[model samples]
Target: MPPSADPSVSVTLAEIARIAGVGRAAVSNWRRRHDSFPAPVGGTDTSPQFALSQVEEWLRRQGKLDEVGGRERLWPEFEALGDRDAMGMAIAVTGARLGTAEAGHAGHAAGLLSETAPARLGTADAAVGIPVGISLSDAQRALVERAVSLARKQGAYETFDFLLGRWLDTHVRQIGVTPPPLADLMAEVAELSRDGEAGDVGTVLDPACGTGGLLLAAARRWAGSGSARTPLKILGQDIDPTQAALAAMRILLAGHLPERGDASWEVDVQAGNTLRADPHPGIRADVVLCNPPFNERDWGYEELATDTRWTYGLPPRTESELAWIQHALSRLSPGGTAVLLLPPGVASRRAGRRIRAALLRAGVLRAVVALPPGAAPPHSVALHLWVLRAPSGDGTELGRPVLLIDAADVRTEPSGGTQKTGRAAIDWPLLRKIVVSAVQTGGNGGNLPVGHVSVPLIELLDDEVDLTPARHVPKTTISTDLSLRRSWTRFGTLLHELRDLTATLSALELSTEEPAGQGTVTVGDLVRAGALTLRAGQQPADGAVRTGDAPTDSVPVLTVSDVLAGCGPSSWLPAYEVSAGEAAGTLTVTVPEEVVVVGAYRAFGAWVDTDAPTVLGPQLFVLRVDPTLLDPWFLAGCLRAPANARRAGTHTSTSSRIDVRRLQVLQVSLEEQRRYGETFRQLTAFERSLREAGAVGRELVDGLTNGLSAGRLPRDRR
Candidate 1:
């Protein structure tokens, strides 16, 4: 076990990399090459822990800490707190001290010396405060003092935001804070929907606010608007007290920032289950923005059965998102607008049909916009933005039509030409334009755009009040003749390419007679001979991998699916040392050039990756070969053979896993291997062309059939 003393706390390999200001791979190399490196004190073999004191001493003796900053050195200690909740509280406490210091409170600036419990700041003042009744451990106190000292050198807001950003990055999955782009988009949509006569949104509320992302977005939006001088009150509630405190501090710091300009903003974030207990129930806001928790089953259903907030109807027990929706609607004042980011299912789930009908009939729900996949959390599914308005108590708003905009197809093309897999990036600017324009003009008797539809209220009151935008938005089409011509042209080009590839493959001659003295060797022999190194991919560390298009600062991850499809990495993880260094948990990242093999049943394949550094995902094996000893392409080809697959496959009722080391390879000279590798490369290209041709052929047939059925094509003159 690691020592319990404060100075001898345990640290992971990842934390050591952070302290040394180097990549995890470097630390891994050090461990293997250096005799003086600290030994594991705890944790499992895969993620071994080392004593902090010994590691620090080793690093200092090696002169590795010379360029490391104080903040960087303190971070590992902060992370050592172990408990995420406690770490968050420590960060919040640090922010509070910085705020008090900025406010000229010397007593509070003494850094947690006084025993006075921290108080939650009221909404009336702009003071940043910590969570009430939370006490720091001795370890946390020492870390906070170091943090405060750093804060004094760097501005308080900058230091606090830096810590908070790092915390959010590490705990991304748990926190699920709204992406800044999505938050800004929501704020813009709300701003567009507001009534000009309301004299600017005086107040905003995020009932399910995680870390005040939406609130801050609103503040930035309104600060730049005509209402820049207006006082905006921000109210928020969360189940986690630490998150609530952090949210409050974040907003308070934003208010004091010089760039935010003398805008007066008040914020109060209460901690509790917003559904079970109503903290600000009596106060309605001019604007409400939320990215509520989705599909929660235990969201105070029985206790709030008769709650008056469900003006449309009591939400179904299974449809907790509906409850949040109704809560958002209830919190809207007369003519107030609310923009909610909800899963697409909430718009069309059967259980919420009645509530959907009620909202439509009462003209509360205004519009539903379908965002592209990867726009926000739960990124695999396309989420929706439901724009709603509180009834003004007049009948004039009752008969208005509901606008539906489907921007799900609006996505930026993948960055690299070779990247054929992975979620397409959401074209936020285009999405914003399409959605905002549609919302602003759809209800004003304007002709709906191609992806926009304006449906009457009575039309949605049918047996199923499905509000999914895809079901209602009309599909775009080209003129039949033009479409047919384009399809034919594409088909012809694909066929020409396929024909050339087939001819080239057919011209390749092979000896049908088998050699009597053929030599075969297993992959294990190559590794034993020091000709190759095999590393099995590991499950990435928690919160390491991100789904969707690769960001500029991220490295692509090669998954089993990507291997099977013979495509580039379908997912990516941030490449910054913070996350990337720990991406593969205990395994170092895949070597720059290697042959990657998938090991799943019926999905086994191998490919040579010559691209930039890529992280190997789980259930895969990376083979780094010595160029002089083995040809990577030749080895990949041999491993991908069907006969070799069966020979190495361990079959079960469910799956057939390939034992890569047991796979057989032909013993051949390097020159002969190069020749075989070239042939294999051509074969792979031929297969790809065949698949492309088949797809184009299908499109051609479908177009011709549709054109004929629609009587848009002339009959052939025989």
Candidate 2:
């Protein structure tokens, strides 16, 4: 295969592995085994690179083209284009074609020309109706055709989003990509707030729309709500010109195409700072959703000193988030809703306290929701979403209660400890439902749901006017009779469990003698001796049915979180399930005498004793031990020790990877190892008992306190 003229159009080994849907070791093996494999055309000796065109051709010849995705194949060509403006314009143009395809066949207007020659680089430029100052090669044209074909097969939305998501993922370190869950939640909040309004929401706006994520979410929500036929106008403004163009394209591609004569929806995307340059000064929108840049000091404060948007009060220099809030609020029509994602600090910051108080008095600040960290970008800190409505200036409306939702503890996992590498996984659908439901039922002076409460405006107008949801939301309330009944039942259950545990502990014969180590054997030695085998799990693909309960399918997939939490397989996605001959593919079939170890050092391992076959999720390591040679539970217990965890921590940085080969195992007979495993099991049971007892004890204290605080129980005289 002839190499491309440009050496810049090459990928790293890791990228190649991702594109090929295989392990990095597989790529290395291919390079060594095949003489026809593309030779290194660039990069250092430590990390050689191959020409993308040559590599792609070789993969096709090898019948591995099916392994590579369309987006994966097209990205190298996109990178090769090299002009940022042209690339943005090209993406937008492709998005338009996708939109046209989504709209149904519309002849030449939809770029439905014969496939005699693939659309060239200037093709999207023509579609965009502008000059992007770039030309396309024949290779680039073919790449575009492949992308369009893939989009057609995958459905336009999924394909477009996949490409956009990958692009964002690649540049996340340089420019923050708003986490999809957060963006969707913000849009849902805005949509919910528009409920029971005077008119339908036809105009949606996002002033600092980074890449039109918020607007796209809004459009999706509208489409899902039986309004697909309605034409909704979208407006976006951003500081970066390239980002602005991309945002315009995203909204255009995402819109519902007209079936008959022409498209009804109108899009206007401007490239300018919203605060410094008020591009759409006089236009008020029905809904505004924004995840503005936080802590931006140089936001042209001096130039906007006399701006009219600051109706309540001028935002301080340190409170740029407050400024974004005002800008969004100013853009909302009367009784219209706006949802803004901001740092938690903005809710209770001293500088913005007066403004918060003013907004509350005016009834513009409707709700403040505190989200858990890792819900959005800047995953290190928890953020807040402020729900606002343009004031109608009615005194009775100003007296209404404000809803506060404290979702700081709402996470897939408990937030007591630090995560090793990635942020905690989120249940986005559940989160959106919770927030929207809370907003709908809140502030009626009636009963609120758990994790939510309504505070009277009079109460919120205190000296501080602080809006921290956790501070204001009422604690889980229990009456005297109910509290006593619940506490007694819990105490009885705990006592019974304790009694059972004590009896079981008494039956175990745990040797008090110290363990004797005749020799040390590494896990690698056991593997070399054919005493054990190791393997890892595959990541579940898109559209997979993931569950938090018992699987409805034939197999149970164990996830890393399940292992970390010391539980059996509970959650499973549909992608791993096989039908007939599909079983011959990558889905793992678990056997008896297996130990599942969490890949991170923060957590350890579990010994599988289930009767049925199972599979493992991503980042979980499986050690299939020979029962006659080594006890599975014994190895798992050894791996779970703090000493071994610390040792593993030293071998890796940032994320501690388990090097099973380096793990030291005790040399002992299988029977002796079984005895040790029994002892370990007993200890684990005791630890669990202590945790349950502690939680039950806390409940008792809370019940007693709540009963007294509410004056529902008489105080005993001592």
Candidate 3:
């Protein structure tokens, strides 16, 4: 537990959580509960602490060696993993084993060392089951029990998340993504710091800091560079307390100090929402790196219509992304650079063109670097990085030259990532080198001779005022029917992947009907269970509505954009908030949503967990379960199954958008119900690794099309 003098080796509790795959409480528990837990033998408590060997030994004793086991195994195995999923699995497994041992459960831990099912978790689809206190079809009930028993044997039976088994998130796809590369953040930071005075406040900040990924990289690079990153100030803030705390812990564990430390180099993480209440509202930094929430709609548009941060244009009611852009711009001091990760639409989309024009006319726009898809949390789409400078007049730097990057043609790895993350992570090194070269070119961060044209800022004022990178960047060739060609190719693969996943879901849903089955009863019969609760939504003061068949002008509908901005029409909401007063003038209001649904999920018939005040739509059926008889979290694991999605489609009530009553008709035993939850818990972790893999894959494909030997994969059929 001793701190490291190397500085590069020192880390804190939060950072350990990110690297170790455990919560801070778990780390604290290890420090407090285990007498032999590595104690900081030397170095200041505020500095990089812990002996690597000691920590490793401790992890080993706890059965947390993670797969190949031992320090000697960490690198070779990590390097051998030829796929991104495999790499993430390895990292997670290592983190888990390290954690399992710390929790004194190492003996019960299993590893996720590879993508092949057996290489990680057992290679079998788990059984179907119902949520606690809810009934299930006879077949599903039996399956649930079987899974529960198996999961108990594995020993991890209480941590299920919905995204694991789902092939793709309907929500993520519907919302889309403009994956900004972590490399872009690094490249921009590096660009700003090139040849700058030492100890000249080399810092990076993120308003909506998620996991502190960008911050960690900057910190690590600084820490490792001897004293080049002097007094490295890395700061991050978020609206969600959990995310902020998580980021804080993560930053500390990266061998740096948290906000509690005296050194300005100490972590500067804050707990409240950044946008609504800027904690360091007046503090401008040398470099600003951020990937704010994307295309938010109804983002409290009415409330902050007159905020000062709206330097560009009044972002339309449906344009939260633009607000973030301007907000980021406001944070930069003159000569300070801001690199923002944006979605593709933000660049060329018609609606926000004027605001884009205004920003460009101001000469703040530096270089627009294009990135392949699958870079950030919502990793299914392409993204861009906009590098803007605070109009520095150091006498030489910003009068006429601005780099316009056309990186869509860069070479990529076969598995869809840049070269830096090895197997399938973002190629931060490649992109960084490219961008740094393109922007600051001849300076210390030498720019590569890119085929960029220095068009006058006035050119951006042409009728379209379009900022799309593709517009200015030349294409080597063109297929007249690009869309048609995409359709022709992806037509089959998309259909196949879709059909296969659907079949899997259907198979999971098939009921074993036998004389109405034993323990089966209608939802009305189980009204006494009280395991499900309904939160039926009400009509908004000026609500717009829509059904799947027709696209109604239903108040722009409940899009992901709305939800990310805190006002979307759905059962689930973003895990964040932007508190007022603590922030600068610009603040957004959360809009009330319309409609709600009663129990209509899988195993659990409608009417569940509705005690909290909420706004739900018919798409979400409410189910109230008996806590005494069932664990709601466990039951929810089963209810969110693919099989359930299919079953709900048919068994659910047709009126008012599917209610929960249809689910209880299927008989299920409480014993088996618990099993489904256990099984889900067993697989929940794989979600991150799986998605990371998919993200790498998506980026690889995009990068390849722009330049690759794999030929080309088809586009998604809309």
- Which prediction has the highest lDDT against the true structure? 1
Question: Which structure is stronger by lDDT: 1 or 2?
Answer: 1
Candidate 1 residue 301 C-alpha distance from true site, Å: 1.2
Q: TM-score, each model?
A: 0.81, 0.63, 0.42
Tell me the tens digit of each residue's lDDT in model 3 across 93-191: 322222223223324333321212222221111011101121223433332233233223332211111111110121222222222346435544545
lDDT, candidate 2, 1-718, per-residue tens: 1224455588756557766777779989999999988888865443566787777778778877553355666676666675554455456556656765654543324443222332321121122221123344565565556667777666666666666665554444445567667887787777677657624777788898888888777766653332446566677888876576567667656554343223245566777878988778888888898889989999877888888888988889999998899988898888889998888999888888999988987888888898877677666567888999887555545766788987765555322222222124555665676687788777443432336878888888888888899888765542234545765787787777778878887797767888676676887788899999977776655534233222133355667676566444554433213321134445544666577666666555545444335566676767888888988778887877777666755465536677767777788889989988887766666666666677768888877786677786656788
What C-alpha RMSD separates each model from the true structure? 5.8, 10.3, 20.8
RMSD of candidate 2 to the true fold? Answer: 10.3
Runs of candidate 2 exceeding 4 Å displacement: 1-69, 72-90, 96-146, 149-158, 173-188, 191-195, 220-231, 256-263, 372-374, 379-382, 393-401, 407-434, 451-454, 476-718
Model 1 gets an lDDT of 0.76
Task: Provide the lDDT at 442 for model 3.
Answer: 27
Q: What is the lDDT of candidate 3?
A: 0.47
lDDT of 2: 0.67
Predicted structure 1, TM vs. truth: 0.81
Candidate 3: list runs displaced more than 4 Å: 1-181, 184-199, 223-230, 256-264, 393-401, 409-433, 442-451, 476-718
Ranking 1 against 2 by TM-score, winner: 1
